[model samples]
Target: MRVIDPRPLPPGVLAAFLDLLGPERAAEVRAAAVRIARGLDGGTLWHVNSTPRGGGVAEMLHVLVPLYRALGVPCRWAVVDGDERFFDTTKKLGNLAYGSTEPADRLGAGAADDYLAHLELEAAQLAGVLGPRDVLLLHDHQTAGLVPALSAKVAAVHWRCHVGVDTPTEGSAAAWAIMAPLLDRADGVVFSVAHHVPAELAGHRVAVVPPVIWPFAPKNEPLPDDATRVLLDRAGLGSGPVPGNVVADGPRDPDAPLAVQVSRWDRLKDMHGVLTAFAESVPDAHLALVGPDPAAIPDDVDQAHWFATCLDAWRALPLPTRERIRLVCLPMDDLDDNARLVNAVQRAADVVVQKSLAEGFGLTVAEAMWKSRAVVGSAVGGIAAQIDHGRTGLLLDDPHDLAGFADLVTAVTGGAVDGTALGDRAHEDVRRRYLPDGDVLATAGLLTWEIT
Candidate 1:
């Protein structure tokens, strides 16, 4: 129901990618831009989601929306307004979709009605703003409830789901059963992977669109010397001069090897696992667990609970081992600054980790790899797509295998594996596939084929 105005992003980012992409791929991008210019269909494209900050959806919009407009595509963004109860139900459904072993909270008939009523009110507000030719694109389960009302009012409604179950579980099945009708109203749906498309979606058109990272965004771009040191020190990582040879990193000792994982304090990201793996095996390497400060975003109702649990896990470690591992909550007052801090942390890390127990797609994985940092991620969902095992990055066969994770960390930090080589290849993979330029073409092609 509430909309956040998008700030202007620097234009001409795509122009720089021409050299990175070479003459052939750059021509393809130019061709897509020409197609986009020809196929406006006289409509404004609108993207709808829950929050304006945090999460992959918001982060992507922060970059993609600007790029689209800069490329001469007419697009706008809106964030839905919901109460705690609504978000609580959506969060439960999300975890269920992931087949989380945590306690199950069912969304029965009454609960579904409660959820619909809120979306109905929000849709009432949307009606006045959407024009006859305008089309709506909703992201994730958080905004799915609006599809019913939006379908009748808009030219087309495409439900794009960012979180998904790679392997269907009873909980995920139950979630789909409840959402089946609301989903049917949409003209099309988009998923991160082919497997993420639910069986129930067979009646509608579906597209597989991988989650992407902006290579030139403030968060993904490499930081300069003066800015890197000032931001790192301001973020509480200390003011030591940044090492010129390595990616800009935190303060400790210039040459100290570091392993880092930057994600929400969710159970799935397995921050505790990263800490345990480092303490048990790679004791010589320092570990940093970084996440957004909970106070920065209001929607993630479970952040405090998850963060407290991670703290409990950290406190249980021995004092000597504990001092080597740290928990960092970066300030979000300045989003660009927050992004830059993340950039520095990832670059500074000797090996970046994304040890999620379950992942829809690891945007952070691509972010790390884009910075040319070798990543060790769990072999699940989009992470499997991003990493080619021993080529771009290493993949853990099993997420829960602490010993196996420790072994890989030890191997990477000990120089048994060529991390720099892995990082170089990883950068190339992103340049070829995961860059946001592809997203523009993909979105335009999808809407062109489906909307008309």
Candidate 2:
């Protein structure tokens, strides 16, 4: 693990937060969170997700569980156990949730039996170590099936769905059928956005809790110059003086400008679309596509084969355009380094583009906005919620609209809009809407209302 500077809770961190939220509003939220925590006295809150690492759900729990402990709430996080076969089935279910209908082997009658057996085994092992007072907070569809098996033993269960569900496909329906009984048994359901909730779940009590970024956490703090350089070097971003030292170790050239897109190389992210837009809009600007390979999997079928296909696609880019583009896959353990790279990129970038075809709340947008960087993101999903056109950042309607995206990039980079003004507004927006303090309070309020 990369050791980060010790972050003590600063008085001003919470004070400034309260000021941004206003005393009356902040007090009410805090009181609610405290009430929720108090209500579950001696109960443990267990957060279960598909993977122990990677993705937003796991990332949020990384900080959230610890913070809950700090607040005197006993909480723990666990990963569901599954083989490649299991993950493939889940991935198919994921696609279905997104409204795609590729064929998949049905979970069959034995499927539920096998799944319950696994859940019982894990639950028994956990129960040996933990008392029955614990509350279970399940994340996404993958582990939602476990709820029914554990409902009798657990004090309460909450399902946190991170994906949007504007449309439901046959696969989604089947997956839901397998999991609905479990969800129906849940104490409550949590959605990241209002639109992410399915109509079938409308009658049930649903809570809208957006994911949050911890401002004082190691991954969110400012990096030192030496540390930044070391991280950049590891990512092969280069060393020495270059413009906008976005990659920590990369060389910085004060004269040149940079545009960065950080996301998994998944089809839904539209990485190629971003490349096309950048190529057409700012042909002269350096573009860096920074993220882990989407095809790489800790547990999934033919991940290496999938990864190879993505690599081939990247390698096939035209030489001239590819020269300006850099693809990086940071190790899972290097989250601190990733944060440093993000800070460096935002500090050095003239513009940060998300341009995602589909997004689950776009935490990257919130992150860049927190740093007060100008951003251009596609008008889809949660990205639209975070960005205000010509205010905090610009919103592009089409990811493939090369000419239009390019025009916005040029205007922002060429000083058409007041850079300082835009940055300041972006910062304010993050402070008001996406910070951890507010998020925790809102979640606590919802949990309190449900559990009480």
Candidate 3:
């Protein structure tokens, strides 16, 4: 197991929220933080997840751990080490939970046994370091197995699942059957939305906590137009080609309207579907399908495969279509730089799209919304919670409806949808609902319940 030392943001960062959250909500958040600090009573608040990089969970924790720490709570983060087989099995379980049609033959009783054995071995080392008063938040299926072994050792064990399907499938049900027993020992279960809670978990105390974005994080920070241009040009993300990180067939048009979808190269994110939609319908604009380099995220075993799948889809398009599209992999050597680039890209985009087949919560939707960019997302999972159709952003009722998606894309990018007005409302909505303060207060509420 590896411990991640979160980089500290400036002191008094949360205090700035007084203006953004309004006096009443900000007071509520501050009061919750005070209560949480008192509840810990000198005990640590530990967060355990599979890795500290490469995904939304990591990006969020990077901001949140420090936020809690600054709020005077003893917050710490640790990563559980896993072998290749461990990650592969966890990925299969996640895919199953997402209701993916992919095969899950390996997610059987034997695999469950092996999974628990590995987590138990990892828990032994963790249990030794934990105090009796400490609270543990085990994130996603990757760390769910730790609940049983560590539950008795901690003050409370809260298991939070960051992924789930809108509609239950046989595969998801089977995956939950294996996961439910492990989670039964947990003091509480947290989900991104109510719909993500499986029926199997009905007996457990469940809290639907929306995921958050740190507006102060480099990824969400404001960049001036010149800085956006300089960074994009330096990274070869814009029209004037300098040596850069983006992978594309040719140079982009400097003045063309751009639509960007930034997500992991995962099947559920539907990068291929977005590519197909853009090529077939939105002829006047350029699309950039951006994600991290597959080699950077070792835990997601399917990244390389999905990246290739998108590559194949991009190649199938006509020369003219290919010219207007870019398949991008931002460098991950420096996470802050990567985030800054993502910020620039989103800031540069006319419309942001997240056409996910299923989502726990599309944090990207919130991030784009924060930037006041018009967003179009599939109405499944937490995406619906964030985007009020025809208001803050747009939503597709069916994810597989590529033509409908194209029409929506055409509507937003072509100026028929009043994207600027939508983006303005989206920004305000994010400030109200998707900020870290809300996430922290909800989590505090859950932890307080468990400890009581």
Candidate 4:
């Protein structure tokens, strides 16, 4: 196990919430923080996950952990060390949990033994660092195996699951069957939504805490129009000299309407489907499918393969369609800089879409919405929970409907719908539901439940 030094953020960052929360709600937030602080009795809150930089889990911890500390709660973030084989195993389990029909050759007894062995090493390391009064929050399927060994070492253990399928499948059932037993030892379990809780854990203490976004975080922070253009240029999506970190096919058409989807190069994210839909129907608009550089996330062993496959698919498209689509790989060396680039990309987008086949909670959807950009997302998993379908944002009922997805995109780009009005409402929607104020109160409630 390795401790990740969080980027230093001032305690006064909470002051940014004043106008958004208003006087009364802001006062309520401060009071909740005070009460949770008293309840902690000086116990440190610890978060454990697979990586510290690439995906949504890391992003959330990066933002929320600092905010918790700023609010006077003692907090620490840790990333578990795993080899390629270990991550491959965990990634399979993750896909299964997300209801992927992909074969689970890695979930057998031998795989279980390997998974447990790795967590055992991590548990021993964590045991030495954690005190008797500290609370541990294990995140996702990656760290679920630590529950039994570490439960006795900490004051309390809570597992936070960030993925789920709206409908259960055989794959999901099998994955839960294996995980439910390990998670039984946790003091409580937290899910992004109630449907994600397995039937096997019916009597367990479960809390539905949706993920949150920090409005002030680099990824969601407000960027001026000029600054956005310059960042895009530096990242090689425009006329400026291409930086070593970015991989782009050609310069983007600044005059053409831009539609962006920022996510990992994962099958479920459906980046290819987005490409196909863009090429076939949305003729004039440029689509930028943005993701982190594959080499950065060592924990995801298949990232390189997935990214290579995506690149091949892009190359196979017709010349004109290929020119309209930009496949961007952002560098992860400086996370803050990477986030700023993402913020600029999203801010410059005419419409942001998340055409995910399955999702735990689409933080990208919330991140874009927080920026007050119009969004169209598939009505599945937490995306459905976040979008109200034509009110806050548009939701496609079927994720695989290529024609339907294209029509929705054209609707916004063609001015058939008021994208700006939808974006304004989306900004308010994200403010109401997916901000840290609610996240803190709800999470603090979970901690209080565990401690008492």
TM-scores of the models, in the given order? Answer: 0.93, 0.83, 0.96, 0.96
Best by lDDT: 3
For all candidates in order, the CA lDDT equals: 0.80, 0.66, 0.87, 0.86
TM-score of 4: 0.96
Which residue ranges in model 3 land beyond 4 Å of their true spot? 104-109, 242-244, 450-452
Once superposed on the true structure, which residue ranges of model 1 sit more than 4 Å away at CA?
Answer: 17-23, 33-38, 104-109, 239-253, 450-452
Reference-based lDDT, residue 416, model 1: 96
Q: Write the per-residue lDDT of candidate 1 for residues 1-452, one digit (tens) a residue.
A: 87666876665665776666688877776667566655656777789999998888899998877777776777889988888888888887777777664654566557778888988999999887887777788998878889988898877888898877778888888778777778888978888877877888888888878878887788887788888777666545554543332222335555668888999877778887787777787867888888888666666777777777767777887777776777888777878878898998888889999998878888999999988998999988889889999999999989999999988877888999999999999998988888776777677677676322
Residue-pair clashes per prediction, in order, are 3, 11, 0, 0
Model 3 local distance difference test score: 0.87
Better of 3 and 4 by TM-score: 3
RMSD of each: 3.7, 4.7, 1.8, 1.9
Better of 1 and 4 by TM-score: 4
Candidate 2 residue-wise lDDT, 355-416, digit = tens: 87666687878888887789988877688888999988998887657788787777777778
- Could you arrange the candidates by lDDT from highest to lowest? 3, 4, 1, 2
Clashing pairs in 3: none
* lDDT of candidate 3 at residue 149, scale 0 to 100: 90
Higher-lDDT candidate of 3 and 4? 3
